[model samples]
Target: MNLIRPDKIIVGMIHVDALPGTPNHQLSVCEIARKAALEAKLYHDEGVDAIMIENMHDTPYLNKNADHEITAAMTVIAHEVKNAIRLPVGIQILAGANKQALAVANAVDLDFIRAEGFVFSHIADEGMMNSCAGELLRYRKNIGADKVKILTDIKKKHSSHALTADVSLLETAKAAEFFLSDGVIITGNSTGEAVEPSDLAGLKSEIKLPVIIGSGISNENIYTYWNQADVFVVGSHFKLDGHWTKGVDPGRVQKFMRTVHSLRQ
Candidate 1:
């Protein structure tokens, strides 16, 4: 079966609450899981094509590796979310924790993962991140999780790409495709920022893999990327008041899905 639809795929993000290891840890793991499951149900009910649970609230993220506690906590939350929704579920551990995210997806029987630092070396807020497509794919093979698709980000957000300024975005995307990424995501400079329409157009024109719009999608500007992008991963806009840290607003989700449905027609 296809992992996602042939038309525009709408993925809603569940910014999971601060896990135990992070500085912002306030709620118990059970509480956090409950909240995540509720958000997943909200997205499923509101007509999202898929749901991605992320450890976005884990500030001061560890570079490239998540602690065992973070992984265990995420597993619990991911299980709860999987039970709550029938739509395709995915996970992303912040700061390039692709392996842990894959482990969680494998355990929870998730469909996909949003991986960062998959192809090129760049300076992220967490520090310098190098390409991991080789090691990550090998790990996936070892763990027997090849069924879980890896949708990678090229020149991802919250990073400095000056070291690779000589490389164009298309070249970066080609590298990812060459490295065996299932799909490629294009994002803006940071969270909640709009992606350049020209960049989206350029990449779509050249790349044959699935092209995902990873940030800054909303009811107002969905038209700009309607035809060029295969998937739209929305987070901040679905929350209360368009803030990433707030709870999922049902009204906002309904409104946005309505717009997407109209576009699909």
Candidate 2:
């Protein structure tokens, strides 16, 4: 694995999931593709560091391989978005689809990937996910895809950490560092909720790797975590009227941009 890079402001998320075959999330890939590319391009235009494409809609999560339909749709969209935006591109395949995400990134020349359960087990809405850091790292090296960094979810969303209760969040983060994760992410246990400042503080005390605020970052509280987190993957807050299923709210994205830019000033 390559060394993790800090001192960056990566921001983006996968907001569309109702691709060709899936529709539960109230969006089709066709609807989301052009719109999401335009939205991501807008963020790039605002000078955000990096953008990640994910399948945030294929809900009722599966802890394993997603149907080829989901992967194919994301590949097409990721390619289009990469072409549209100037910043680094990344991908996250929903429901613990790490290998598939890697495959897609490789196919589309994405710069990185967000992997859930990169190390240790977690009880997700779908079920348990065992650590794949050892295998994933080796696989990346084997396939000569080591240049693509893996931003691991230290304590991922939509899950319970009771299984790792004896293990502190920082401890789990340490294991990921040792296992060679390029960076770590902290979530609020679900979408649209901010990661606890205390949790962020605790993890910060333990690791030097790049840390990201994974979910619930928005115009309201992004200021709070801006300096603390290297990147912010925001989605729900950027949607139309604050609804995750609605179209990209350029107004919301602009508001976040203004807030973040003000701090730099």
Candidate 3:
């Protein structure tokens, strides 16, 4: 479990284009893997601190236990990405497939996973998502994947929290910390949206685990969040025209990395 220990880490996102069996699957698995490996290499060369691979293009993601085809395709892509870079690599299966991600991470020797619905219940686009900390941790233990870290997302994106309105974000973070999450992630309402600065401050004050900002980080705004978050997980801003739907633009990645390095100094 000896992972990146920097006070602040910058994670570039490798949103693996839609995999086989998903709605947007356009290329073969080999093609997808090659594209992902290229992106990982680009991030590594650009001096990114770490990288995370996510199924972001798989629109209309499934709930827990995504299709076996999705898992198989991801495993192949992750293996390629891991082999292509030296930096710590993580995986995130879209929707709330925590255990599936763990399985894929374990299979491909990934360092960590971004898990949604690790604690507490909320309505997601997929459906109602119940807390999976108990089942997920037990499964992780049973599968002997303890070395893989699980960073849980609290009050995650693309969801409604009316049920947890009585509980504060800090309280939800506390629940995640109590549940033994290796880290806690905070995101905006949806993808590519900036997280509230006050929310990051509140979570840092209330939680002891590492705090990661999961979306909407760009070269233009890195300085504002550089000191507040332990990790900045960026995706959309690194793509062409700053859109998530586009492919990773190496120039954008380099510019963001330069800004991050300057701020780090």
Candidate 4:
């Protein structure tokens, strides 16, 4: 069965609280799981199509290869959130922890994962990120988690793409397709920034893969990219005051879903 339907999907983000071992860590694993599940429940009640749990608050993230504790903490939180909501759920570990995210997803029976640096190289705030399509997919298969979809970010946010400046966005997307990415994500320069509509249009016209709008989708502008995107990964817009670091506001979610529902018709 295709987990990501052909119809437009609105994936709400559950920014998992600071996990143990991270500098901002304070909450116990159980407490973090409780908070995440609460947000998941809210998203479900508010009519989101799916949920994506992320360790966004785990500041000063490792460039790659998250520690065992981080992985363990995420596993607990993902499991709890998955149980709290019936919608398709996914997870993303910070700073390119694709393999760890996959392991957690596989263990928790998650529907998918949002991966960074699935193809090509880029310099992120965390550090250099290299293509991991081959190893990541292989690891998925090896772990018997082929059922979990890997949605990758191309020209990821909060990073400089100067290293691949010679390569056009379309070329990078084609490369991802060539490497067998389940889907390719398009994002702006930083978090909560709106993706250029023309960029989504370009990929939709040329690529056969599902094109996901990864950032800056708000209730107001959903109409602009509605026709072009297959999936909208909304985070900040649904949070209180449109801030990623704040708690999710039920009112914001309802308002955004209202716009999305209208677009679906």
Candidate 5:
């Protein structure tokens, strides 16, 4: 958990395209791995603090454990990206496959995993996603992978929080901290959307763990959250045209890093 210092750390996202067995599957596993490695290199060269590889294109994501093929493919891609870049790398399996992501992180010697549905139940695109803090921590312990930090999403994107409507986002973050999460992720309604500073401030005051902004960061808005957020998880803005599905744009990455560095000084 202390691996990342409490600064405006920038964690780039390598949104790996659909793996085999998913509905959107297209490229061969090797091709996908190559592309991921390339993106990892780009992030490293651009001085990104860390990078997280996710199975974002694997549409129609599962609410439970992912298939063996999906896990295997992610492992392969992660391994390649790990070798390609010196920056710390992490993994996040779509929809709430926390255990699978942990297993992959363990196998690839990754620094961490981005877990969804870590605190409360909510309706995600895949289905009703349940909390995994208890089960996930136990599994991480059983496997002796305590070195792998779990940065969980509280009130995660692409989900409805009607079930936990009575509770506040700050309380949800407190629950995550109580569960011993390495850090807590805050995000907008969906991918590529900007996180509200008020929401970021709310969670910052409530939890002692690292408060990471999980989406919608760019050179344009980085100044706003530069001092408020501990870490920024950027994906869409790094891509060409600021779309998650597009290839990484080196210029965008360079611009973002420059701005972040200036703020640090």
Candidate 6:
């Protein structure tokens, strides 16, 4: 896999509500891809170092097979997004769908993947997710997709790792590193919620691998975690009216970039 260190990484999030095969919000599959691809292009133009496309708006996500249409649709849109953007691309198929994400990365030439359970799993919005490293790592090998990196999300968004409550935060980071994760991401419990800087600090101390903040970054508290986190994944803040469901907000993107640049300088 091409090296993508976290410190210099700034990712623009593109949320597509529509499932791969079906129309979402009254839009056709092709339309959904067009909108998402265009949004991806916008993020690239805004100077984000990377773009990750997720089907966040698609609700009631299944842990098993997506209909043929869903996979087909995701494949098509992912292809278009790759064509439109010059930056490295990544993908996340939600609800613990690590294999699907790997498949998408392979089909689309995405640089990396954001999988829910590349290591251990706890209760998630979908249910108790089991570890997938066994199946996921082998699938990647079988597909001949060693070039794509897998960026695992530790204690992912919209869920809890309470089942692992007995485990120390630092221990969790150690476990992820031992699993051979290329990188690890830390996110708030839900979208736009601020991740406590202390959590990042603890995770950073335990693992030598690159760490990324997965959500809730804005112009406000970004500086607080700047030193702890190597990469920042931003989405809602860059959306219309700061709404995740709306279109990309160029002004917000520019504003956030300015603040981040100021800090780096």
lDDT of 6 at 176: 78
Clashes of each: 0, 0, 0, 0, 0, 3
Off by over 4 Å in 5: 1-6
What are the per-model C-alpha RMSD values against the true structure?
Answer: 1.0, 2.4, 1.3, 1.1, 1.2, 1.9
Please provide the root mean square deviation of candidate 6 (C-alpha atoms, Å): 1.9
| Highest-lDDT candidate | 1
Cα-based lDDT at residue 79, candidate 2:
86
Tens-place lDDT per residue, model 1, 1-265, is 1534656789999999999978999999999999999999889888888999999999999999899999999999999999998888899998899999999999989999999999989999999999999999999999999999999999899999999999998999999999999999999999999999888766777977888999999899999999888889999999999999999999999999999988888
Task: Quote each prediction's TM-score.
Answer: 0.98, 0.91, 0.97, 0.97, 0.97, 0.93
Question: Of the candidates shown, which would achieve the greatest TM-score relative to the real structure?
Answer: 1
Error of 1 at 16 (Å): 0.7
Evaluate all candidate structures by whole-model CA lDDT and list the values in order: 0.92, 0.79, 0.88, 0.91, 0.90, 0.79
Error at 256, model 4, angstroms: 0.7
Which parts of model 3 are misplaced by more than 4 Å? 1-7
Sorting all predicted structures by TM-score, with the top scorer first, yields: 1, 4, 5, 3, 6, 2
Better of 1 and 3 by lDDT: 1
Q: Give the better candidate number (4 or 5) by lDDT.
A: 4
**C-alpha lDDT of residue 102 in model 2:** 87
Question: Looking at model 1, which ten-residue stretch has the lowest summed lDDT?
Answer: 1-10
- Measured with C-alpha atoms, the lDDT of residue 61 in candidate 5 is 83
Cα lDDT of model 5 overall?
Answer: 0.90
Task: List runs of model 2 lying over 4 Å from the truth.
Answer: 1-8, 23-32
